[model samples]
Target: MKDKIQSFFHLEEHGTNIQTEIIAGITTFVTIAYILVVNPSILGDGGMDPGAVFTATAVTAAFGTCLMALSTNYPFILAPGMGLNAFMIYTVVLSMGYTWEVALAAFFVEGLIFLVIALTNIREVVLDAIPLSLKFAITAGIGLFITLIGLKNAGIVVDSPSTLITIFPFHSSMQDGSFATGGISALLGLVGIVITALLMIHNVKGNILLGILITWALGLVCQLAGVYVPDPAAGYGSLIPDFSRGLSVPSMALTFMKMDFSQVFSVGFATVVIAYLFTNISETFGALVGSASKAGVLQEDGKFPRFKNALVAQSVGVLTAAVTGTSATTSVVECAAGIAAGGKTGLTSLVTGIMFLISLLLSPIFLAIPSFATAPALVIVGFLMISSLLAIDFSDMSEAMPAFICLFTIPFTYSIVEGMALGFISYVVINTLGGTERRKKVSVAMYVIALLFVAKYFFV
Candidate 1:
């Protein structure tokens, strides 16, 4: 069995043993397992059933990660994306006043579009058209975005009435012995960050996973000591739950096969579908390239060797998400956590998928992990991803400016699509004005993309 498994994954060629791969997989799983709870909570705010969304989230993650492992042979995992889910619930359903069923239909149609594009040469063409500097910028931009998300989740950052944003009063309140204002959660997150950073500095193999477990243990201890007060305003203060009640099976009746496609082909809905498609494309490309580069799996040309297979897997995952009544699924940047832990092949993803499957029965345990505990892992992963900025050529103004825009705008605007759009548009405009040769170097597809994005921004 060991030999067969080794041969199947080319584990030896990848310089990884089964044990390392399994550990990497577990590490990756722990870092991303928060999605099981977070996704359901977010979608439930849009009037979907939390129990059904929970089941869908787990099932889609397992299915997508397994397909990515078998088809692309990469360590990346796919799940319902955080930003995309927000767009679905806040923008599509709430603001636009569309039913969740209609949004699912839009997602399904977008998935089909992705499927067709991935199967063709368009995927490679779009990838090739992107400049190397922009790729690195996208990677770094995603890192900053992830870090911002971690800070928000940990309650270390909050809205400021005076300045646009400001630090939470965790420290000030703690100094005054006040725990009512989310200081406890912030303190727990800080401890987790310190523990994880220390373990990483010491070169521990499973530092991330170990840090999460340790933080969770501390939360349990605090609960027993009666210091872990649940803050309803913090959104994730209920980290400890009664385990004696045992597991309750989740209901899938509300969300399973709930897509409504009546308005899919209409002009108005087509715009929404196109928006979803573009966001998914940009996200998948950034995540795959970033994680693969970290894993040392990119070719000399800085492209994934199995790009088409990865896209196919991602598209299938999105399609499955729509069918299961969730938002679109895409490659997660958290896969970098596994790569940083020395995962180099698909076996890591296979293990992660299996763990997600098992999590279906252990939902309560996984769900009880508060965002503050996982926030530390995300901050560390973000730092690892931002390290790729070293590859960008800062000397060239043309490349540096667009790259800088891409990197800074991602976290600032809090939208990956907007960052990528601004970057691509600037790249095309700057190069076009540079010289005829430079303009000629830009691909026709890029010019078209720039125009489409401009239209989407102004007209759509």
Candidate 2:
């Protein structure tokens, strides 16, 4: 009976035992944990403290995810996500100059919008209305962005003269004063991915998880050895970027809210939200499928999920994140890693939850985990994501164009929402005016999707 349940999500086949699942879970946790530190850094520059924001994200991740794990039979985790956080900082703070409080207000407002749309089942309609190619393109675009982030963080690429970025920065040596001996992110990310790929080719068990662990350890060693990484300046305290700033309920809610949300749309809020929705959906899909696959609990057809139940848990998660004082509606990618790690029940999430709850008391300890250490994992993960591009149907314009647009726009534009919006609009326009297609009855709803896309581009 237990095996059957696990198999329902396709977990037993992949995730295997408790030990393997735990490792995967931890790896996933490590991959995204830096947000606790980095988010505060990004948001704090706008006047929020470094420590408080990080703590808020960490606490929400631990507590919100625990709620998710406890509430559902499915395996998933909750955390403030890449796109949303970036949106809040870049589009909201930098582009709009909103305080953390005003930002938090917008976040909560967005959560409300999300809840309404999701409950209305508009999620399915919009997803369906989005051209499949566009989805692929958006997915690919995010993959490129993730890859670029990894590469940049690894010091593989640096500020160049001609282009926005360059493959090599220093003439003969790295920025940190080392020759070939440094550049651990590049070395580990490239080498680790190759090794993992080979192991995968050989059908080795837990190759992905193994490769991540090995690279993580190696990166840490390099950090300690005074390799290519630069030491902090005279008064540098927390090196990895802290989440403590701007995370208090009052700070995030009041500070972020002071900014006019009217400006959110002006600063590409629509674009940001649209892109964020795509990434969030992607993470959720992957986590759901991967967990089920690893546990051997996935349905055979791979159709619908436990939508209503899952949404209930997810809704609570978004709300909790705002209350805790951070970004909104960030569904974690690591939850799938946990599900893969023999997390038969929510016990695995429970463990992670307790760890997070405990972290509030020991925020300083978490602050010490260097982001450079995690950069390798992200780069490797980006490599893994690129594999999805092959799944796109090149022959179908409806599919191919959207896919290509989404793939190209995200990294190039440094904006996920822009890519998604373009893809969505392109899909509708192309299908409606392709002239080569058989005439069929078009729905008023389809036209609505198209018009909204136009609004996103010109009106907003």
On lDDT, the leading prediction is 1
Tens-place lDDT digits, model 2, residues 131-222:
44554565556667766765655556667767878764344655565443434455665676577668667855545545555655665566
lDDT for each of the candidates? 0.81, 0.57
lDDT of 1 by residue, 208-316 (tens): 6677768878887886787887766646456675466588757788999999988775554665686687667867887888798898888897766888899999999
RMSD to true structure for each model, in Å: 4.4, 6.1
Candidate 1 lDDT for residue 76: 94
The segments of candidate 2 whose C-alpha lies over 4 angstroms from its true place after superposition are 1-50, 87-106, 120-123, 172-271, 293-306, 436-450, 456-460
Worst 10 residues of 2 by lDDT: 233-242
**Residue-level lDDT for 145 in candidate 1:** 79
Global Cα lDDT for candidate 1: 0.81
